[model samples]
Target: KDSAEVTIKLKNNRRETVASITETIAPKDVLISKKGSHPTPYDVIHKAADTSNCINIAFLAEGYTETEMEKYINDVKTATDAIFAHEPFLEYKDRFNVIAVKSVSEESGTSVPSKGIWKNTALGSNFDTFHSERYLTTLNLKKVHDWLAGTPYEHIIILVNTDVYGGGGILNYYNLSSTGHKSFKPVIVHEFGHSFAGLADEYAYDWEEIPMYPLDVEPWEANITTLADFKGKWESLIKKGTPIPTPETKDEKKAKNKVGYFEGAGYRTKGVYRGVQDCRMRTNACKEFCIVCKNALTKLIKFYTGE
Candidate 1:
């Protein structure tokens, strides 16, 4: 195992602060770091996206008591191990390291801090925190940047022990705050798929925000597409009749009904298209990742492990 230290810079209308983040590249086991702050109720870390050396996954954990501490550690281990067990990750076992950070919280609080699969009201709304949550108080991005600068991690994954739902985003970072109601092991894996894998939401519904991706522009995601440049990813996987905009019909009798343009996706409709009407990215069914996602993940693993 090897480690590096880096500094992150955070600036705003008020002032600029720097925090140091340490990254330890590991091949086989999980790497743990000291809690950056006391009474720290949350955890954060980075993962290797497409980088050199062995570090593949990074995480941060937070605990307030011995019992919670033990459970948090064990839960993170299980989630990280399970992630690598799947395709792509399984294919690059030697290079994956899910890094974690342990933070403490006030003993009186009923729930610890960890993000959930989605809609973490406990964390105070969704993206709002990203804008309103004080930089140094919650996540000192400058420090996090410094921490990651020391390692070869290109992608980042964060873990939290509370029972509430956890969530992850793109370069913006993900949150998996705890609900303190049930075991969040499964949610950990699901959310990581989004945070670490660049996985898109597969399910569909309505949202206040209109279409996010431009249908004509085509999507960079391996799984979904606007058919603008399908050749790179799912073009080959699409069945002969698979329409440009995959269908959502479950009835086999309507197999023909399966291949047609459908609406609703990527938090919007009209333009963005998805490979299938439903997938693990969009729902909680635990569906296998679409071929494009699988291959992308596989490539990511190879990029890190050289396996």
Candidate 2:
């Protein structure tokens, strides 16, 4: 079937068919079996206050050989520490469970096509995705899902054992990050913002003219806005005295930190605006999520844990 059709059965035994969703299957999208594969064991890195009532995140090891399992565990620790050290997560540390799955690979580093280097990583991740050198990602969704078949996980984080600086995340899908980069800690948290809370990238790129958000329609994300439907966004969080389109001036530095809409976000220099002038989603230096992102994350956590 070109699309997957799902049916919902009501309590009264009534059946309702929902719209079909298309599935894009690539030639590389082959399924791998864990049976007799001697799948590596997993460890509970962070024990939630109540595993039955809290969010569970699983960090899967990629591109790390069996001998380098120690390094993989340490890398997971660094990523976990960085996550809980920030707000929203810090306040709700007890409401999360982190696990590290030691999925040992035959090789120790990911493929860098730009440098003509390739390794037999557990997950076949590589750089130069879509011709973008920094875009690191993997097409092995089946392998990722197969590894977490019986785990109590709602999120997946693949830690690639490479020092090259690159990572990518798709909301509620997966997070792929390098383990040994200088910016690894911050980058993981930033990518987590994308995967965990559906937070949009707050950074703007002047060279590209990518229009991910239409000016007339509101973005589904909680952070960036187009003023088309600001009412549903963080408009109420804006300070009383703050300007609508917060200026990029030194004079408004204090106000910039406030919950005012700052122009330049979502890779666009105009129309789109983010909740704060600086945030973890915007730059690597900012280690904290903006108030708007924190609020959204809190709501998402509550939804997941029924708290």
Candidate 3:
């Protein structure tokens, strides 16, 4: 009936900080059969296995200056609407609820403080101006937990308005936004791909930070793995000639005809895995999710909706 708190130690210093975030069951009164419902915070219900409900998405605008508040809200709402309007999720439109929160724009992360608090960088550019550390630190997990647990939603989606290129994620922690003049719509979808569906980034690149999952083992997720034990997950979707390393191409024909391992995926160089080498989850191109990500999301949708 309430939310839970999580404490994490910083990878750099092993300093412990508590994160406050909430995770509660979706309230019974919030379900609607029609569109334009403006679902309330209390309307977000948590049914991990209920096919009638999807994850509750919450948007947080940490504004140090009042100047950007209104614009922030509108931009984020538009971005979110556009995102869910795509694929498998659009079919279950009524099942998800979205909410927005306004919080103090606290300064976070000494290394990249401008983006406030975040764990990693995605579209690295503006190092400071729009920075809001919505991700890196765990000092507010307790409050976040309380807010989510007290609400009707099971998961919380956070969109930070700082123009920095930082964002973070966990089993249910909020997703950070990239700050700048350009449209961040694609990044919003990309971050959600990580936060909501447990989807891993398929692009390979160097990063100062390491990933949470090991590449050598069969991943616990239903999609994206090193195929160490391919049969454990995603193997059924593999078609013959679909190599272990998938190539990055815009070939729609290839997307339809094969399921192969693409190179430069899973955020690391060594692991051979499956996924469209180019997807929103893998790049800033705002492309559709790979079939692998879709299948995983479909399972999550079914889990929440109880369908």
> Which candidate should be chosen as best, given TM-score against the real structure?
2
Sort order, TM-score high to low: 2, 3, 1
lDDT of each: 0.49, 0.85, 0.55
Q: Who is ahead in lDDT, 2 or 3? A: 2
> What would the per-residue lDDT of candidate 3 be over residues 1-307, giving only the tens digit for each residue?
2333444443321223444444444334356223223432332122223343455676654432245556656756676675776777676666776655443343321235553544331112123433443343334554555434334445555555456455555556556555443546777677777777777766666762345446656666555677667774656666777655656566766654456676555556766465555566766764577677777888887787676
Worst 10 residues of 3 by lDDT: 39-48
lDDT by residue (141-197, candidate 1, tens digit) is 544444444433455544443444444455337535443534344445556666665
Per-residue lDDT for 120-164 in model 2, tens only? Answer: 988889999998998999998878877777777899899999898
Ranking by lDDT: 2, 3, 1
- Our tally of clashes for model 2 stands at 0
| Predicted structure 2: lDDT | 0.85
The CA root-mean-square deviation of candidate 3, after full C-alpha superposition on the true structure, stands at 9.2
Query: Against the hidden reference, what TM-scores do the models get?
Result: 0.62, 0.87, 0.67
lDDT score for candidate 3 against the true structure: 0.55
Candidate 1 similarity to native, TM-score: 0.62
